[model samples]
Target: MSPCSSVPEAAESVSRFTERPALQSSKTLRAAGVWTGAQQTRLNVRHFEFTADEPHKVGGRDQGPTPMEYLAGAVNSCITVVIDQLAARQQLTLEDLQTYTLASQDTRGLAGTADVQPYAHAYRLQIAITTPERDEHTLRQFAARAEHICPAINLLRDANTGLKVVWSFTEQPTAEAAERLSNAAVGYTEEHDAPKPFLTVTNADLAASVSA
Candidate 1:
């Protein structure tokens, strides 16, 4: 006698249990490798430099991240790091991860021109995330969580900005030694130093025969 109930309507529950398959547990859930580096104090780029300090003059011209641009870029970079960390932890294999961001704003004479909002500028990001396994439900759940927890997603949500992502999958090769295993796969012949024929070759006998 099971401790479970046996009401007249309890037959439905028993039937469901009978129809349900037995629970199957994985024998071993491997521990994926660790991924590090989450801080971004600065960026290394030859074309530009961005710092939190006051604007610095570059090439006799003052330049640096504009307040709004910095906000947008921060969201972009944060989202990337967040996704990377989450995916790595989830043991999701990735082929390529890319984000394209666009922001729109309306200029109204620099802040003082009439009481107006900044056109409610929006930030649109298209993220291409590839996975090794095909699990639409799991992927969708991951994406939902990723969007909710990602810094960029949080920022956009807080700011009432529009945000969306286009998901895609592509095969990604493992990061292994890139050295050629064998040149024999495609052999090459060494060049030999040889005299070149500077003049065209014409058979004299053939020329005479034609003349005849």
Candidate 2:
């Protein structure tokens, strides 16, 4: 299906959120995981079930993507979805959107051989889009807004992970253009500022009222 096929629905959802602020509320997400065997985990979230495992080099069957790979995928998917929704809300004609994500990690931390961080140190996303707006500044601002609202991107940024995003825009999305984009050198790159960590607060008054 065309990427813009859901724009109408996205626009309607955005309108609902704008029209009714009360409809926006905190939602809890739940997921469960079970360790099957040999560095493999069976995961369940909502009605979806998937497996995560390590490769032969890590001593497990390469049944599925590793947790780190999943993390990268989550970031990419979140950004894409956010951008799509934003485009819909802005009434922008979005013909195509694609993203490639890369992460750098030090496995020594996972092996407990070094005193280093176990998670990804940095993440890079290459974003290609076909849109009617040709102004570079406008496109960058639009993407920045989407990045600001993207949850996964914020999660990594709050954790002090370095992020680099490169954007490429085209008037037409052709197979040749896509191939060039995949192998081309860097274009416009954006490095966002580090986000401030949120502070958790305890509602003593609410607790007292509940107890009473």
Candidate 3:
């Protein structure tokens, strides 16, 4: 603990800190990714070091997961985290939860086709959840809440990438009910929009200096 002006002042500071509004996105969070050649990208995020690479066919040594795989994993992880929080808040017991991400890309733009998306611009995620006692409606509601708030999925949705959350319930709902729930699940309800991202590229030396 640092020197405090007074006990009450310290208490007030703590209160202010705790009551401060949360950041919406990555306001101050920063990560550094260094390209170490041969399709390997080394990353440092909050003191944790990891790597992203491509396959051997793509000119990489097949060392680790490809960057696309990392992106899918990020979305899956974020969805799970949000769902877990929602379940805990709702006092729902989850026996198991599994998620699959399907991301498709059209290379027409890469082939110089006009108005075609080059990168991954299509995605669909299917989630299968198991619960011992919760109603299907409750779980669907939780999923909707999760999608509405999950940063990663929202980022995808905001980019206009096609994403729909399909469901498979292991406890109670019939096929028809499940289908209805799936239709109401976040992605299915919204009008389709194209997703876009703001990306910036800089020289390696400049990036290094900034991180340093």
Give all candidates' CA lDDT scores.
0.45, 0.66, 0.61
The true-versus-predicted C-alpha distance at residue 114 of model 3, in Å, is 6.5
Report how far residue 178 has shifted in candidate 2, in Å.
7.2
Best candidate, TM-score: 2
The local distance difference test score of model 3 is 0.61
lDDT of 1 by residue, 25-118 (tens): 2122222222122222234345554443223432212234554666767766787788788888998776656554556665572455766556
Task: Point out where model 3 deviates above 4 Å.
Answer: 1-27, 108-115, 172-212
Q: After superposition, how far is residue 10 of candidate 3 from its true place, in Å?
A: 35
Task: Write the residue-wise lDDT of candidate 3 on 1-212 in tens digits.
Answer: 32333333233322212343333422455789999999799999997999998778758888889877899889888888987898898888876666667777775775587687765787767565666754545655565566656778756765657765554556532333333333344366432221111111212222333454
lDDT of 2 at 99: 74
Q: Report how far off residue 155 is in candidate 3 (Å).
A: 0.9
Total clashing pairs for each candidate:
0, 0, 7
lDDT for position 186 in model 3: 39
List ranges where model 2 is wrong by over 4 Å.
1-24, 174-212
Which residue pairs does candidate 2 place in steric collision?
Answer: none
For residues 168-193, could you state the per-residue lDDT of candidate 2 as single tens digits? 67666655343344344333232221
Which ten-residue region of model 2 has the weakest summed lDDT?
193-202
